[model samples]
Target: MRTVAARTTALAAVVTAIGLLPWLSGKDPALSVLRARSAEQEATEEALTAIRDDLGLGSGPVALLGRWADGVVHGDLGVSWVSGTDVLPSVISGLGVSLGLMGASLAVALLLAAALSTATLVRGARGTLRGGAATGGAPAAMLASVPEFLLATVLLIALGVWLGWLPTSGWQGPSSLVLPALAMGVPAGGLLGRLVDDALPAVFGERWVGLWRTSGVTSRRIAFAALRRAVPAIVPQFGLVAVGLTGGAVAVETVFAVPGIGRAALGAAKAQDLPMIQGAVLVLLVLGLTAGALAHLVRVRLLGPGLRDAALALPSPPRMRAGRVARAVPVVLAGVLLVVIGWGLLRDPFTVEATARLAAPSWAHPMGTDGLGRDVLARLGHGAASTVGVALAVCLISYLFALTIGFLPAFSAGVADIANALPPVIAGILVAAVLGPGTVGASVAVALISWPPLAAHASALVQETRAAGFLTAQQAIGSTPRRILTRHILPAVAGPVARHAVLRLPGIALALASLGFLGLGAQPPAPEWGLLLDESRAYVERAPWAALAPAAALALLAGFAVSLSAWAGAGPRGAAAPAKAVS
Candidate 1:
C-alpha cells in the first residue's frame, strides 16, 4: 500500500506539472497549437476558440489534470495535440526498442563496471584508489565527462564513417544497437565503477577480511567476499544509472537516429505534440521507478534481514591524501584547461567568414574555421566560458543548496532518489516549456537536479556523525541540535562534501553539453561546446576538426577539473571519526 501510494503520488505530480505547462509558461494553448500545426494559419478568435474546444484546452487546471490522470490510468494517452493520433500506440511502438536498448546498455554498464572496479581494487591494493569514489581521480570522472551524445558522435564518425565497421544510424536489427549502447553505457560504467571501487575498501577494512587473511584465506577469496558485502550497499546507485541511461538515450537516439522513445519525445517536443510528450515522459517515469524499486529489492534481498538489521553505522567513505602521481595529474590538466579557458575569454567566437568556412587547420587559422566559417579557435576559447564557467558556477550553487538540505537525511535522500530517477533532461524539458530554450534555462535545469546527490551524501555523513562519540559528547553538554549540526556536524561533513562537489564538475558539464546537443540549451551563434558539436554535424566529414576541437576540449577540461578535485583531496582530512578515512 505504501509503495502504491508513493508511485501514484509520483505519477500525479508528473501529470499535474505537465498539464500546467501552458498556464505556467503564460502561452496561449490554442495559439501555440495553431502555430505548431500551421504557421500559415491566421490566429482569428473563431479559429482559436475552435482549437481550444476541440483539444479541450478551454478546461481549467482541475479538469485538465483530471483528464490527463484518467488518460494515463486508462492507457489512453490521448491524441497528440497536433496530429490527433492515439499517443499510446505511437509511444509504445518505440518504447519497446528503447527498453531493449536500455537493457543492453545496462548489461554493458555492469560488465564494464565490474571489470574497471576489479582492476581498480586490485591496483589500489597497495595505494590510492582503494578508499572512496573520488579516489579514482581522473579516469572515472573523465569517462563521465564525455557525454553520451559526444561519445555517440565520435563512434559514428570513427566506426560508421571512417571504418565502415557498423551501421551508423537507424534501428536496423541488433547490429545497430551496439554503438548506441556503448555510447550510453560507458559513462554509466565509469560512474558505477567508481562507486564499487571506492566502497570495497571499506569492506576490506572490515575485521572479518583481516581475520580470514590471517587464518590462511587466499587474497582472491577475501576480495570476492568483500565485493559481495560492498555491492548490496551501493545497489541503489545502479538504479540512478538506469535513470541516467534513459536520459542518455534522448541524446544518443538523436545522434544515431534510433527509433527509441527518446527520439519520439524529442520530435514531439519540437512539434508541440502535448500528448506525445506526456506519453513519452510517462513511459520513462514508469521504467525509471520500476528500475529503482527493483534495485532496492535486490539490495534488500541480497543483504536479507540479517545484514540489514545487524548493520551498524553505514560509515561514510574516507578521503585519503592522494599519492604524488595522483596529485600531479589534476594539476597538469587544470593548468592546460586554465590556459584554454583564459584564451577563450579573450577571443571572438561569433564573427562569420563564409570564405574560410570549413577551412583546414593552418598557421593563419590554428584550429581552422567551422561550418559557418567562424574561427574554431575563437569559439573553442569563448565556448569554454559558457560550458566550463557555467558548470563551475552550477556546482558551487548546488553544493550550497545541498548543504542546507543535508541536515534532514530522510527528506534529502528521498528527494535525491526521485531526482536521480527522473532524468536531468526531464528537468530541461520542463524548464524549456516554462522559459523557452536557452542556456540559462538549461543551466537552471541542470542545477535543479544535480544537487540531490550531494545533499544525500551530506545527509548520510550527518547521520553517521550524529552517532559518533563526539556529537554525543556535545549533546551531553546541552548543545542544541541546530548548533550541533551547524557547528560540529556540518563542519565534519563539509570536507567530504566539498570534494564530492569538485568531482561532480565533469558530470555537470557533461549534462549541460547533452542539453545543448538536444537543442534544449544554447541555440546557434552561441559557441557552447554541445551546440558547436551539433552545428558541426553537417560538415563533420569535410572538416573533422570542427567536431574534434570541442570534443577534445571537453575531455581535457573534464579531466582537468576532476584531477584538480582529486588532487585537492590531499588536504586536511575530516575532523570526525566517520568523516575521514585513510585507506
Candidate 2:
C-alpha cells in the first residue's frame, strides 16, 4: 500500500511538472503577440522572414505562459497549431483510429498465434508432420521481412482491383480497413507465435501438466489452462506492442488514405509544423506511458511476487496420462495451414509476358497477371517471401540487440525509471535525420524502438528471479555473479525473454514497414511493400490495385506476426506465475 501510494505520488508529480512547463518557459500571450508583430514587421522590411507567424498564436508570451500554467493546473492539454481548433478533438479522433486498428490487429494476431503455437509445440496431434514447427515458424520470418505498404499494395491488386472484393482506400467506413488490418495483423500474429511456442514447452514440462495428464484432463484442456496462466505475462508484451503501433500509425494511415492522426502528423512534418509535431509526439508519449503503467499495474496484480517459486513447486504426476496425441488436433490443423500456404507460394505456376495485357482467366495466368505483365502468382510468392524474410530478420536481430543493451540499465531501478520516461520515436527521428534514411536508418530505428522493452523485461526478470530461493542458495554458496546470471538466471528466464521478444515483434514490424512506406526502406525497383504503396499513389483512382495489394499484404503479415508472438507468450492455465512481473 505504501509503495503504491508513493508511486502514485510520483506520477502526480510528473503530471504537475509537465503542467508547469508552459509557465516556466515564460509564455506571455500579450508580449508574445507584440513580439510577433514586431518580428513580422521587421522581417517584411528585411524580406528574410521564414517562420509561420500564425502558429500557436495567443496573448503575449507571458500571458500565454500564465494561461498554459493555469490550464495545466486545471487539466487542459491546450489548443492545437491551427487557429480556432481545439487540440483535444484531433487527438481523440486520431487516437480512436489508432486504437481501433491496434485492437483489430491485436485480436487477429493473438488468435492466430495461439493456434499456431498450440500446433507447433504439441507433438503428434493431427497430421503433425516432422517439420511443422519450422513451417509454422516461417510465417514470422516472412511477415517481419515485408513492409505493411507492400502487403497492402498486393492486397489492393489481388483482392480489390482484380476481384473487386473490397474498397481500395479511404477511411469513411470499415471496408477500407480490412486490407490494412490484414496487413498489420498477419505479421504481428507470426511474431507472437515464437513466445507462445517457447512458453508452452516449459509449461508442458511442469509437474502439474503431467499430473493433470494422469488425472485424465484432456491435452486441449491443459493447453487452454496453460494459456490462462500465461495471460498476465503475455499482456504486458502486447501492451508494449500497442505503444509501437501508435508510433507506426502514420504510414499505415497514409497508405490507406485514412484520415487518422498519422496522416496529420505527416502533413505537419512536411510543412515543418513544429508545434503540430510536438503536439502529436506529446500525445503519443502520454499514450505510450499510460499504456505502460497500466500493463505494469495489471502484471503486479496478477503475478505479484513469489510467482516463480510457486510455478517451480508444482508437482509432476507419477503416472503420465495417455491421449496426448489425440488432444493435439488444433496444433496439427495449424501446421496444415502453414504447409498449404507455403506450398501455394512455392508451387510452380504459369507466367505472362505482355505488360498491361488483360486476358480471360486461363491456366497460363492462374492468378491473372497484374498491370506490370508479371504473373500475379509469381509475384505473390516473391512478395510473401520478401515480407516474411524482412520481418523475421528485423525482429530477431533488433530484439537480440535491444535485449542485450536493455539489460545494462535494468539492474538499477532508478536508472530504469528514468530511461523508461524517454520515448523512442524522438530518438528514432533524430537518428533518421542524421542517418538520412535507408536500411541503415531502419536498423537504427529498430534498435531504438527495440531498446525499451528489452530493458523493461530484462530488469523486471532479474528483479523477480533474484528473489527466488535457488538463486539465494547459490549466493550463499558463493557463486559468482556472472555464472549466476548466465547459467542460473538467464536459463531460468528464457521463457519470459522469448515471450517479451514475441510481444515486441508487432511494433518492430510496424516500424520497419512504416519506414519503408515513408521511402526510408527498400529503395525503388526492389519490390519492397512500402515502396510499392508509395509508387502507387499516382494511380489511386485509375488503378487502386497497385496500392491496395501491397498495403493489405503488409497489414496481414504484420497482424499474423503479432498474433503468433502473443500466442507464444501466453502462459498455460495452472502454469505458475512468470519469473518476473513483465512490466
Candidate 3:
C-alpha cells in the first residue's frame, strides 16, 4: 500500500511537470502576441477592438480564454485554428487514419515477431553452429542496428518499380496502408523478435518441460504452453517499444503524406503556427499517456512480480553435434556475404541507369530518376548507406546514452529510478525544436528519445549483475566495481544489449527518414532515401516509380534489419530470473 502511494505520488509529480511544459513554452509567444495587442489598443480607441481585429474573433482575450476553458472542461476540444471547423471532428478523422495505420502495423509486427520466435525456438539444440555459436540474438542485434527508412526505401523501389505492385506514395485505398504499415511494422517486428528470442529459450530449458514431456506432453504442446506463460513477460517490452512507435509516427505520417496528427504537427511546427502546434501536441500527449498507462496496466496484470525475472533467465540448449567445419562454413559464408554487400554498397550508390536500365523493363529513363535525376542505383546505394548508417548510429548512440542513464542509479537506487522516470519524449521535442530540423536534429532526437528503455534494461541488468559470483570474486581480489563490471558483466550483458539495439534501430531509421522525407532532415540534392521519395511527390501520377524507389529502399532496409535481429543474439540474463535448468 505504501509503495503504491509513493508510486502514485511520483506519477502525479511527473504529470504536473509535463502539464507545466506548454505554459512555460507558451509564455514568449503569448507575451509577444499580447504586447502587440496592447500596442494596437493604444494606437486605436476601442476596448476590444484590437483583440477582435488581431485575433479575428471580435471578442476580448478573456472571452476567448473562457471559451477554451469551457470547451476543455467539457471535453469538447473546441475549434480548428485554421478552418474554424469543429476541432473534435478534425481530430476524430485524423485519429482514425493514424490509428488505423498504427493498429495495422502493430498487428503485423506482432504476428511476424511471433512467427520468427516460434521458428527459432523450434530449431532447439541443433540451433548451434560452429564453436557453439549463439544465433538469434546476434542477428536481432545487427538488424536493430540498421534503420527503417532504408528498409522502406528499398522495398518501395523493388515493389513499386520492379514488381508493379503497390503504389510508391500517397493513399489510393487500403493498399496505401501497405507501404507505411511495412515501414512501421519492420522495426516493431524486430523488437518483438528480440523479446520472443529472449523469452522462448527459457521456456525450452525448463526442467518441468522435460518432466511434462515424459508425462506424455508432446514437444509442441510443451513449447506452446511455455510460450503462453511467457506472454506476460513480453508485454512490458512491447509497451516500451510502443513508445518509440508513437514518436516515429510523426515521420511515417509525413512520408506518405497521410493526413494524420503527426503530419499536422510537422506543418504547424514549420509554419510556427502556435494554435495548431498546441492542438496537435495536446492530442499526442493524451494519446501517448493513454497508451503508456494501458501498457503499464497490462504489464502489471500479466507479468506480476516474476515478469522481469522470467526475461533474464538463460536457456541451456541441448549440445549440438554438427561438425565444426559445417557450422563454420555457414557462419563464414554469412559473414562474407555481409562484408561483400556492405563494401560494395558503401563504395558507390545504386543507379538505375548504371545498374538496372538494360536488365529492367524499359520505360522513360528506364529504371527512372529521383527528384534530382540521380541514377536510382546511385541514390539507392547512397540511400542504403545513409539508411543503414543512421540506423546504426542511432542504435549505438541511444544504447550508449541508455547505458549511462541506467548505470547512474547504481550508486543510488532512488536516483536511478528517478532518471528512468524522466521523459525522453519531452527532451527529444525540446532538443529538436531548439536545433531546428535536419539530419543532425533527427539524430539528436533519436538519441534523446531512444534512451529510456535502454536505460531501464541497463539499470535492471546492472542491479542484478553487480551481485553475480564473478563480480563478488573480483571484488574479493581487490578489483574495483567498475573493473569487474567492465570485464565480466559487460561481456555477459553485451549480447542482450545488442538485441535491444537491433530492436530499436529500425524505428530510429524510420523517424530520421520520415523527417528527411518531410523536409525536416536532408534537403534536396542530398540523395537521401526519404528526401528522394519526397522529391517525387509531384510526379506521383506521371512517374510513380520516382517515389516508389526511395520508399522501397526504406522498406527493404527495415525488413532486412528485422530479419537480422531475429537471427542474432541470446536472451536477457539476470534482468529476469529463469526457471531451473532442464537436464
Candidate 4:
C-alpha cells in the first residue's frame, strides 16, 4: 500500500513537472500568438507586456502550477491561444475523431493478424509452414516496413488517382476513413501477424498439445487452441501496436486532413501555441498510461498467478540454427542501402525543368516531375540518403549515450520510467522549439529521446551478466574491475546493443520524417523524405507520382530497417547459467 502511494505521488509530481514545461520554454505566448496572427510588430512590445500580465506570466512556477492544477481538477484545460476557444471542448471533439479512427484501424489490424496466423498454422501441418510463412509474410513484412506518411500517400494515390475509387483527403463521410485506416492498419497488422506466427511454434510444442493431438484433434482445432493460449502474449504486443497507431495517427491525420487531436497538436506545435500543445500532450500521456494499465490488468487476469514470474522472465534469444537466409537478411539489407546511397550520390537532386512540371512518369523524368518540375527520381534518391543518414546518426549518438550513462547510478531505472512516459513527438517539439529547426536539432531531439530506453535495456543486460558466477570468480581472483568490465560486461552487452541499434533505426527514421514533415528539420530543397511529402501534397491530385516516388523510397528504406531488426536477434536472451551455485 505504501509503495503504491509512493508511486502515485511520484506520477503526480511527474505530471505536474510536465505541465510546467511550457513556462520553462521561455516562449512569449503573446508574441507567438501575434506572429501566428500576422499582426504588426511595431507596437507588439507594449501589447505583449499587457498580454503577459493578463495571462499571469509574471507569476512564479509554484503559483502557476497551483493555478493549472486547480483548473485541471475542475475539468478546465484553459483556452487555446491560437483558436481563441476553450481547449477542453476542442480536445474532446478531437479525441472522438481519433478514437473512431484508432478503433477502426486496430480492428482491421487484429482481424488481419488472426487470419494470417490461422493461415500459417494450417500450413504447418503440411510440413511446408516455413516456406509458406516466408512467402506469405514477405508482403506483410514489406508493408509493415513502410513509414506512415508514405503508406498513406501511396494509398491516396492508388485509391484516389489511379482507380478513382475514394476521396483523396477528407473526413466528410464514412467512405473517407477507409484509405487512412487501411494505410495505418495494414503495416501494424503485418507486425502482429509476424508476432503470432513466431509464437505458434512454442504453443504447438507445449506438452499438453500432444494430448490434444493423440485425441484426434484436427490441425485447425489445435491451431485455434494455440491461438487462445497465445492471446496473453499477443495482447501486450497489441498494446504496443496501439501506441504506434496513436503516434502514426498524427501523420495520417495530416495526410488525410482528419480533424483529430494529432492534427490539432501538430498545428499547435508548429504555431508554438503553448496552451494547446500542453493540453494535447497531457491528454495523450493520460491515454497512453491508461492503455498500459489496462493491458497489465488484462494480462494479470488472464494469466493468473503465474503473471508475476512471466513479467519478470527474460526472453530467450533466437537460436544459432535459425535459417541462414533469415540470419543473412541484415547483411542483404545493408548492401541494398549501400546501392541506394551510391545512386543518390551520383545524381543531381536539385535540377529543375519547368517545362515538365507535374508530368507523369516518362523516359526523360523516370519517377515523374513535382509541381516545380523537379525530377522525382532525383529528389527520392537524395531524400533516401538524408533519411538514412539522419537515422544512422541518431542511432549512433543514442547508442553511445546509452552505453555511457547506462552504467551510472545517477541515471536509475526510475529515470527511465519517467522518460518512457513522455511522448517522442512532444520531446521532439520541445527540443526543436529550444534549438530551432534543422537536421542537427532533429538529430539531437531523437538521440535524447532514444537513449533512455536503450540505457534501460543495457542496464538490465549488465545486471544479469554481473549476477553470473563467472564474474564473481573473476573478481575473487583479483582481476581489476576495469579489466572485468572490459572483458566480460562489454562483450556480454555488445550483441544486445547492436540488435537494439538495428531495431531503433526505423523509429528514428520515422521521427526524422515527422520532424521534417512538421517543418522542424531540413528546409526546402534538401530533399528530406518528410519534407517531400509535405511539399508534394499540393500536387498530389495533379501529379500523384510526384508524391508516390518519395513515399515509395521512404517506405522501402523503413521496411528494410524493420526487416533487418527482426533478422538481427530477438533482443537480450536469458543468461546461459544461474548466478548462484547449485550446491
- lDDT, candidate 1, equals 0.75
- Compared with the true structure, model 4 gives a TM-score of 0.87
Clashes of each: 2, 111, 52, 1
- What's the lDDT for all of these models? 0.75, 0.53, 0.56, 0.69
Comparing 1 with 3 on lDDT, the higher-scoring candidate is 1
- lDDT tens digits by residue: candidate 2, 100-191: 87678777777878776766445522223243232354455454445544555566667877788888778767787787787667656655
Residue-level lDDT tens digits of model 4 in 129-227: 542223345555555656666778888888887899998777898898898898788878877777776666555555666788778878777776766
Off by over 4 Å in 3: 1-73, 76-86, 117-183, 218-223, 299-369, 374-404, 410-435, 453-511, 525-529, 540-583
By summed lDDT, which 10 consecutive residues of candidate 1 come out lowest? 574-583
Superposition TM-score, candidate 1 onto the true structure: 0.87
- Candidate ranking (lDDT, best to worst): 1, 4, 3, 2
- TM-scores of the models, in the order given: 0.87, 0.56, 0.64, 0.87
lDDT of 1 by residue, 320-348 (tens): 76789987887787788778667666767
Worst 10 residues of 4 by lDDT: 574-583
Residue-level lDDT of model 3, residues 122-163, one tens digit each, is 653332223323246444444443344445555565676568
Q: Among all windows of ten consecutive residues in candidate 2, which has the lowest summed lDDT?
A: 574-583
Among these predictions, the greatest lDDT belongs to 1
N/CA/C clash count, model 1: 2
Clashing pairs in 4: 145-559
Rate residue 348 of model 4 by lDDT: 75
